[model samples]
Target: METKKYPIIVEQFHFDMVDPKTDTNQNVQVAMRQVEPSDPARKDELKSGNMFEIMVPFDVIPPQAGFRVSGKITRVVQTLDYFGQANEISPDDLEKLSRPLIEYIETLTYQVTAVALDKGYQLEFEASGNQKDNQ
Candidate 1:
């Protein structure tokens, strides 16, 4: 595998269980967006080919399965040779850039479910689609 052009740093992570009773299974929904950095220094750094940030919010609903998970994760990505605009990043590149945060989501969910349900659930995401499967 080729090394990624961007380096990712997670700035924030928050996870919570909306429904603790995991009874029924529901699909996971993951969404991502690029937002202007609220910090002035970071905004300036973007212009200088330094970094940009993205917000990834996810929801896992296993209705009646004793648990529903929801959270938002923020990551700051360091750029190399690219700094024109956040939207300018291609969809594929953005997906690749956000891979680590997605894994974070998977790991956290597994850990939480293991302790709460007495069994661990594994979440896997494919590159081409939003489909997720729990094992």
Candidate 2:
């Protein structure tokens, strides 16, 4: 049997900061959820296996730093061939698909901190095998 294949493309992306700057030493938390598109056309596209959406919400707290960041990143990914349900995608695959958005988060945080503080702070995220499903 031939393996089904799907090419994923990001259709839309948006990022927003909740608390742009903060002075607190707290741990970082990251979570991801599959969101339903608000647009009827987008919903149809998703139902037809043409696309799906994933939102990653994160919070970063620096230790004794002048600046902290908390934001959410949402990306709409298009699947070119595979016409399967969103829940059918594996966790590993989901992590791989969300990698770019995660990197964006890191990049933006670094850039923002560079100006907010005297130096830039680097952040690294690892797949903790924890996936949250929000309906």
Candidate 3:
């Protein structure tokens, strides 16, 4: 059988919350955007309509959230494809893509923790929240 493999990119990864432990009392959203592909030698690479969004309930946030937020986007490529068509993704493909997305989520979690820790010693602050933007 003939075969063609296209790239699959994660356009957007949205999460309702990052902290499952405390999400019951709050709301959260995480969004990721994918840009059009580029070629080093080409001055003008296509740049439009290559974005998507995903949303999940706050409760779904993992107990340990970090650079690798479970269910967050993996990677954004050209078209979501594996050994066959885009519609039929293999388990291996899924696993391969998941690693990076998970890493990104884990990283975000650490950033939030660091900020929270930094302010813990302050005496005048009654309450403080940390907003993290991770890679």
Candidate 3 lDDT for residue 93: 44
Q: Which of the numbered candidates is closest to the native, going by highest TM-score?
A: 1
Off by over 4 Å in 2: 1-48, 129-135
TM-scores of the candidates are: 0.66, 0.60, 0.35
lDDT of 2 by residue, 1-135 (tens): 112223333333332333535544333333334445677775765544445666666655554444545666666666655567677777777777777777776677677666656466676666783322111
C-alpha local distance difference test of each model: 0.61, 0.55, 0.33
Best by lDDT: 1
lDDT of 3 at 39: 61
Residue-wise C-alpha lDDT for candidate 3, range 1-135, written one tens digit per residue: 122223334444443433435432222333333444466553233231222222222212333332122233334433222223333444454334333444444444455545643421111101122233322
Cα lDDT of model 1 by residue, 23-128, tens digit: 5444433344444557777566555454556666666665445566666766666666564566677778777777787788778878878887777777776667
If the candidates were sorted by their lDDT against the true structure, best first, what order would they fall in? Answer: 1, 2, 3
lDDT of 2 at 118: 48
Tell me which of candidates 1 and 3 scores higher on TM-score: 1
